[model samples]
Target: MIEHKPLRLLRHLAWIPAIWIAWELLHYEQYKLLGNPGSVFLFTVLTDWLGFHGYEKAMRLGVGAMEIAASILVLIPRTQGFGGLFAMGVMSGAIFFHTVSPLGIDPYSDGGVLFKEACLTWAAGLLVAVLRRDQLVALFNRIAGRDAAVPA
Candidate 1:
């Protein structure tokens, strides 16, 4: 009995975005996001608009931590599905911010590189979700205590 090799490769690819995001976010023991006034202002506006007041630093830290955790999870075969789902959620928020907030598609004037990365990461997450669907189902079954036979 052999497993599908391409799906395994796709599942592994999901970790790439998580690692990149975590590096950009949690580098140097500090949150490196919003380095400029425009980025900060955009975040302030988005935070206020989203109705999450008085905890912007905490929010950034929390989100970064989530990315780091997802990065770790996706690298491990057993937790890849959970990690991919979590990373997708983070990427979705990013895409939404870049789309609707003052963040815009070209924030940081990086020729829309950040936005492109977010889109690519989102797409990779989708690939992981579809390629590892069975693993996700097995995870859910285990969580539900149904004792289903999960793949090795």
Candidate 2:
């Protein structure tokens, strides 16, 4: 199949956020991790601050796994839109936490770099979604099993 250059370029760019986020969460030892004290502390604080405690590890591991999955999916040509959608979801949560939770924009107290990265990633994912809109529409049409006529 002939590759569309613009879509292909966008697809490649979309992988940046996914891979960067997944790496931050997983560190190449995603599966082997069982929740570190740092992660536990952060999640604990998040839960307590948000009153969503009692599932700290689940939240951490679950989001991390999803981020990793989204990253992997973005690497494939056929699933770029799905991956972008998944990434947008994950980044949305991250941005929410950074804004609302005690985490603030500087969770690590570094200098808000993490928050900035989250924003960038979210924006990139959104861009990818927009660039791959045709694919998303096609998928939706397939799933809905009907072709809706587009108004000129």
Candidate 3:
């Protein structure tokens, strides 16, 4: 049985996006968890806009926890797709909030760095998820009580 060379190369290259997603998530952990002024300001503005008011701490901690989980999953070869999906979900919320809320694209006046990173991270997560779609399909099959080995 001959394997397609492009597919083989893609399989190897999949790690690049996986690592990027993981690194981005893990890198932001300190800001979210440790109450960095920038993170605090962002979350405060977001919570205020959402009418969550004083729940900024909870939101920040919750997001930080999820990021930690996603990063760990992304670092594992077998669970990379799940992690990517997790990242996409989280980043989707971030992108939405950034665009719709008063936060705007350049909340910190840092030239929209945060917004751009979120977009790039979302794309990276998507790439990783697509690359590991086989695992996603198998997982879905298992959840749906179908045989993963059988074609749908």
Candidate 4:
């Protein structure tokens, strides 16, 4: 019952991006949820620029909730692919806002730390998605009512 070495290595490697995405999402949850100054500022600028001034709180809370969900999903072995997809979606919005809104690359003026993190997390999520593509395909098959079995 010996597994091929490359397969074993790949299985182990999949956890790296999953853990990195989850850690970043969870670490920032408090700031987003608790109205930390930086988080509030970022959201404010985004909402203002997007003409959603009155909905800043809603947008912030919604993004925070999604991040929490993504973190939870990414940490679970069975749902890692979905989590990666979710993380990528969320980070995509963040990256888009950072680039398009008044919130430029260096929003906090800290040399674009937040912007860089979003980009890195987006890339990591892509890796997770690629690594767990089998699960993603299976999920798609189930949703589409297609046969899930693979030919031997």
Write candidate 1's Cα lDDT for 1-152 as tens digits.
67688866766665665455445434522433544555455566667778887666666656667777766776666776677787789889989888988668986687998788777777766666666677889978988998865542
Lowest summed lDDT over 10 consecutive residues: which window, candidate 3? 143-152
Reference-based lDDT, residue 12, model 3: 69
Clashing pairs in 3: none
The residue-by-residue lDDT of candidate 3 on 25-143, one tens digit each, is 89999899999998999999989988999999999999999988988887787787888899998899889998999999898788998889989989988988898787788989988
lDDT to native, each model: 0.68, 0.70, 0.86, 0.86
What would the TM-scores of all predictions be?
Answer: 0.73, 0.77, 0.92, 0.91
* Cand. 3 Cα-lDDT: 0.86
lDDT of 4: 0.86
What would the TM-score be for candidate 1 when compared with the true structure?
0.73
- State how far residue 89 of model 3 sits from its true place (Å): 0.8
Give me the runs in candidate 4 sitting further than 4 Å from their true place. Answer: 1-5, 149-152
Error of 1 at 67 (Å): 0.6
Once model 1 is optimally superposed onto the true structure by TM-score, how far is the C-alpha of residue 39 displaced, in angstroms? 5.8
